[model samples]
Target: MMKILVVDDDPNILELVNIHLSQAGYTVMKALNGFEALKLVEEDFPDLAVVDVMMPGMDGFTLTKKLRTEADIPVLLLTAKGELEDKEKGFLAGSDDYVVKPFEPKELLFRIHAILRRYDKAVDLFIQAGPMNINRQSYEVSVGKKVLLLPLKEFELLSVLASKPNYVFTREILIERVWGYDYEGDEQTLNVHIKRLRDKLEKLTAEVIISTVRGVGYKLEVSSS
Candidate 1:
């Protein structure tokens, strides 16, 4: 079971997060403040942390910064401060994501799941190709700091192809690797995904795009455009 730590000064919020997370089948731990949360980390690291920004001692920003500097753990900052500056500071402090106060529990749950999925799959959690940075754990693909939205299959396809730049992957190999050989879909499905991935990459002004080799498969290349 995955362990999740929830840090908040408000008893009600802590309770709510704990109940929902527990029901979601995670081992949920609670800390009323950042200090307690850090102490807990010393004993056993949680898979991910949902931290409130305001606390009596060791605010979430400080705690997040410390964790990022030392442990590379993922953090989601939950706070009422929704200003652009506040969000920027959270990112600068090493927060992986930020949620404002009074957020829908389901939204929180989804975000948590995405972040955890990224980390649980890959310990390094990030892949880079040209100007693109794909964060496997965060489910994020970015050019520099700007994140690009991608559909699930498209994202997976991009990851596979970008994992080895300029290396041709046969259609049979791609389907077997990405959709699985057992995938009952048409072989044409791979082409559709490739087209969409190419369009999205172009829209993002990515320096790389998928290049198809006639009678063969495809590879990602650094484009001059």
Candidate 2:
């Protein structure tokens, strides 16, 4: 079973998360602070960590940075504040995902599963496009705590574009990459997928934009701000 470390100052939150994670078949390690969390890491490395932002000594951001730089561990940040700035700070601190307080237990479980799946491979099979996070392994696209379930074709199309943001990919190349060379579909098929992706992205997140380069093809652009 994969090991997961849960860090939060509150005993109630810690136990809540622990029970859920344990029932989900993960080996749970609990910590009340960053110092204790790091000590646990030193003794036994975990596959991932679920950290709360507000703590007495070292905050979640600092601890996340330490886990990322020191051990290269993936973190899912939990915070009561749902402001955009706080979310950005968590990402900047190298968190794999972010969940706000009063979140549904199912949502937390889903994000954890997605993060773990992304890390299961040798090479990182995840894409971070500003506020949007795409998991190639799980076919899940998340913007903050909102997870978007996409069709296989749409997910593959989005993944290809996100793999190289701002790089224009010709229609033929995209078709081949996503649908395979054996695909008998024409350019209209690609156009349909592009349209669907554009609609979804426009509705879901402004951070990631799918732009059509008239003559060339489509390019995915990620907002830095």
Candidate 3:
């Protein structure tokens, strides 16, 4: 499911978006200010964030700019400011879209869809396997409270395995899926990548294990106990 973070000082707006967005089948999290939102980003990486432009400590513009340096997730600014200059400044601050206050919820959703179409990955932008949360769009994976910075190939390999937990992926299948059909590397290549991936994953949690099926491929298995 695509997770969305709603950052607004107004409790009413937060509740409204939570109720409506959650009803729309999206996981919703809220923060009354930008600091909380930033902390949540480290905890749970959302596919998109709806931020209000005016707040106490960190306004939406500043927050959006800060987020740009943090993650690749899309940011949509919600504010009463409708001036073209303000919109330009918002865009300059790295907001994907701006929704003026008193806007229709349907319109908000529509705008969100437009942003997703432009910025998000495939429809399934997120994946959860055991304690690991993966965001395809942001290319971010969090294992429990720790956010891992994995290399490209390692990230893709983990994403492939995590997509279907405990399902054995044959060596050939893993190569085809992760490295592509015309991969010039041999099975040894897969082994090397798996070792690196295992090292990183183990650093996060030893409870999460990647098992190698002899003569087959690999499967991600996590302990329940």
In candidate 1, stretches whose alpha carbon ends up further than 4 angstroms from where it belongs are: 121-225
Candidate 1, residues 15-133: lDDT per residue as tens digits? 99997676444678899998888889899888889999988879899999987787778999998978999999999998989889999876787688678767763233577888888
TM-score per model over all chains: 0.54, 0.54, 0.56
TM-score of 3: 0.56
By lDDT, the better pick of 1 and 2 is 2
Which candidate wins on lDDT? 2
What TM-score would candidate 1 get against the native? Answer: 0.54
What residue runs in model 2 are displaced by over 4 Å at the alpha carbon? 121-225
Better of 2 and 3 by lDDT: 2
Clashes of each: 1, 0, 0
Candidate 2 versus truth, CA RMSD in Å, comes to 17.2
Give residue 188's lDDT in candidate 1 (0 to 100): 92
lDDT by residue for model 2 (125-163), tens: 788777888887787999988999999989988887876
Over the stretch 153-182, how does candidate 3's per-residue lDDT look in tens digits?
Answer: 888788878766777777865775567656
Q: Which ten residues in a row are the worst by lDDT in model 3?
A: 116-125
TM-score-sorted candidate list, best first: 3, 2, 1
**lDDT of each prediction vs. the true structure?**
0.82, 0.86, 0.82
After superposition on all CA atoms, what RMSD does each candidate show versus the true structure? 14.5, 17.2, 12.6
In model 1, what is the error at residue 181, expressed in angstroms?
Answer: 28
